[model samples]
Target: MAENKTLKVPGATLYYQVRGSGPVLLMIPGGPTDAAIFAGVVPHLTDRYTVVAYDPRGNSRSVLDGPAEDVHADVHGDDAHRLLAELGDEPAYVFGSSGGAVIGLNLAARYPGQVRTLVAHEPPCGRILPDAEEYLAGTEEVYQAYRTGGVEAGMKRFEEFVGLSGEEQEQPQTPPSPEMMEGWGRIGGNLDFFLGHVLRPVSGHLPDVAALRQGPARIVVGVGDASTDRQYAYRSAVALAEALGRPPAVFPGDHGGFVARAEEFAVTLDKVLNAT
Candidate 1:
């Protein structure tokens, strides 16, 4: 069983899960995903690492103090910094998926000492891309779609934009286990908040190249082996790595690979973490 805990910080109360026992490895989820997104992989990792996963502020059990507003990467990063601070003084190994990757980068830039190694998986930091404006405008359109027709419309636009739609998306997907399904149930209500407040900010936010490069923490930009270069997030990952003067690390599967290919993803992560 995972130990569930809460930490009050500023306008929100963060809900996080602690599993296994070793050096801390914090997994940060993106969009509507919560601490549970890593459920499939955490068990595989527990033997070697103390796995910590948290629901981002305003998502799932991490409750906002009031009605949600447009949130930024820095705010989400601060929430992570506080969680790490509460966890221990030692810098933690971090893996951030999708939007979580963006937040992780921000945290590393702002407080480099708090993160030892950060594997940022497809951050969607379009601002660093040559065609950044187009992606930014697309995210804005996604937000507007939500405002116009609610979650259904928004997600349809989002999935298509990020290359998560149609027949291909169905293939190579690991069916969610009962635990993951239960986790999704808890996160279902988070979509509106995710679409409105989280998506655009993360998609448009720029990574601090200088801070990350100069920071003591080692940075690894990761992408899925199955992802096409035409995919915005895939390209973003490559671009971020180039800006950092390093090639992107290839993971096992596509964007939601942590879910679909949990076992493989965990093995790859273990190797990456042990490498440096």
Candidate 2:
């Protein structure tokens, strides 16, 4: 059973859930989605880790204290640091996806003392790419697409940005479970906040690689096996891995692997976290 809780942060009230019992493993979900996104993976990890999943301030149940505004990766990073401090006395393991991964890197760079290991899965850190200017422009386009259109139109543009329809190494996809479908619908509903305010600032972050390399937290950059090199996220993740001087640990599916292939992703995640 997961215990629901909330915490008062600098500018928002964050909603979080805690389950299992052992070492702390904080799960930070990407933008547009909240802690509910981890429902499938949580069941598998409870035996070894106390899983803490949350809605990053403004998404889902985490209500913003003021009107909607642009939130930088470091702001979200600070939120993670506060969450960690409130949850446990010791440094905790962290797993962040997409925008959340960007936040993880910021957290590790600025507050490594609060994190033991940070598994950053497919962070859209375009600044590290060789053709970063081009990539950043495309990222801006993605934000603008959402600004002009909506999630439906924006997602189509995002899919194109990630080459989901263009040149992807299309792996056959199993129909997402009903739970996942429901989760997707909810995410779709809240995506305005993500595409509207969260996307640009988070994606635009230029990671402090020197700080991360020198920091105590072990940084594990992750990419999805189902994603190809041509994709924006795949390319950026690879670039980030190179910047970090470590090969990306491959996950099971594409960007949504943790949700689509939860059991396998969980097993792989456990292995990666335990490996020397």
Against the reference, the lDDT scores of all candidates come to 0.89, 0.86
Residue 79 in candidate 1 has what lDDT? 93
Off by over 4 Å in 2: 166-182
> What does the lDDT come to for candidate 2?
0.86
Can you write out model 2's per-residue Cα lDDT over 81-169, one digit (the tens) per residue?
Answer: 89999987898889999888998899999998998889999988888887889877877888888778877777778778766766534
TM-score of each: 0.96, 0.93
TM-score of the candidate numbered 2?
A: 0.93
Model 1's number of clashes is 0
Minimal lDDT window, size 10, model 2: 167-176
Candidate no. 1 TM-score = 0.96
Best candidate (score: TM-score): 1
Candidate 2: pairs in clash: none
Number of backbone collisions per candidate, in order? Answer: 0, 0
